[model samples]
Target: MIDRPRRLRATPAMRRLVSETRVHPAELVLPVFVREGATEPVPISSMPGVVQHSLDSLRAALVAAAEAGIGGVMLFGVPEHKDAIGSGATDPSSILNVATRVAAEEVGGALVVQTDLCLDEFTDHGHCGVLDPLGRVDNDATLDRYREMAVVQAASGSQLLGLSGMMDGQVAAVREALDDAGFTDTPILGYAAKYASAFYGPFREAVQSSLVGDRRTYQLDPANRREGAREIDLDVAEGADIVMVKPAMSYLDVLADAAASSPVPVWAYQVSGEYAMIEAAAAHGWIDRRRAVLESVLGIRRAGADAVLTYWATELAEWLR
Candidate 1:
């Protein structure tokens, strides 16, 4: 008798029953941006449906995200002012910290409240770290700022601090700071293998970045896969509660390797460029939008990511439910 592998491919129910991977609402995280001093939401031209949300609008977004049943929301702040040292990052009254307090109050019980603990959004120079006398990023000095920023973010009620700066020894520094400040229960989400990629173009617009040069000096070279694995190992050793591989689709191999070896949860970020490409293509009627989005995220899940951060988190979660 001939083998009939097509039997499982014969129906939607059969495919669902035998599927090796699944994407769920609980495995999704939405990345949100809240702008300081904005009275209304400002639409990002590059990112079709996303916006720079005002404080009042942020509360509504958090409530909607909680209602959608996604795992959590990661908050990024767009401040009205910028400085050399990114003082806003460490200020208790900074937009990010204030948003954290608001999120904790609004949906703290319903969803995980995470914050982007990076200086790029707050710094006038737009580098992830403080610059040295020569104007190059100073990693050690940056750690000092991270330590101070960690305490403030934790005090502001951030459940998870996302260290996306790619600075050396950042996870350990922030972990020590949080513990020293009596926030021992707070978690660190290390952006372990963030690449300096062209895929971040739309993100620059979303955050209103003032970046003058590329982040190639700190961010990993997209050409090196082994470096990605090494970074994940270092972050894990440095006390990260979770590790992430960014620009998920292009770096699936790195993500899969981390997932295979990491002791902690492995997550992936479907970055702004990835989101924009699909959205733009769909707008042109080049592909079925819903199917593409689902498949893209499902591909990440199949590649061994425990969770995924995507702009479409709430909408995708609704579909998954």
Candidate 2:
């Protein structure tokens, strides 16, 4: 057996028989970016095939993803204007809220509509939370905004609220707000182990973020592994229906830890910069694009993620099918 490693890899049929983790279309959730007031789908140069879609285009994209039988679509909004309080985030008429409504209606019961309940894309300061007098993210103050966001998202028909803001107590805050607002059935997907990562560079472009400073004040430092577990524990204790690890590839250790310990489903987000790097390499013919994409996703799956939120979700599912 020690000298016969090729036996399992000898043929496609053999490989299939021994495959421990198979990527399924229903296990992929596409992360989509929708910009307010966009005339057309604006291609993000850094992300090869990704675009900041107009609302109409967003509806179309969701329809396609739903038809492909993907699990869901995670929405990120690029508001036309952002403010100190990220007023647009809680506004029922905000582009993100409207897009939620449109996607929910367009997909009907075919897809699980989810929304990013974060202020980064809607805040002029480009932080996940509202700033305090010291210009630092005020965790408690931010909780209020998240509460409003929960109701708005629920009213707009979001089945899952992606609480990507890494502020303290966010899960409990949003959970209470949603329940208090009579949206008791809406689930909160807590971004429990979000790291302050260089991998978010392409995400800034995807969301057209106007960030001025770093998010190290709130987001976990990349070096701290134990803290990531603590964060996951806190989120789980605070009523998170599911927990997630962001920038999945580099944090597979954290992902594995979370998956091993989490009481609920554990998910991972294959962030934008990770997508861009593979795309860029493939563009220069350094790697086979299709193979690399599936491999990267498979690696995440192999790390124990129950589901993956990926920019390539729809395309990858279609290709696999």
Which clashing pairs does model 1 show?
none
lDDT of each: 0.95, 0.93
- Name the best candidate (by TM-score): 1
Clashing pairs in 2: none
Model 2 lDDT per residue over 50-134, tens place: 9999988887898889878899999998888989999999899999999999998999599899999999998898999999998
**Candidate 2 wrong stretches, greater than 4 Å:** 1-3
How much is the lDDT of residue 75 in candidate 2? 91
How high is the lDDT of residue 273 in model 2?
92
Model number with the top lDDT? 1
| Residue 271 in model 1: lDDT | 97
The reply for model 1, stretches above 4 Å from the true place, is: none
TM-score of each: 0.99, 0.98
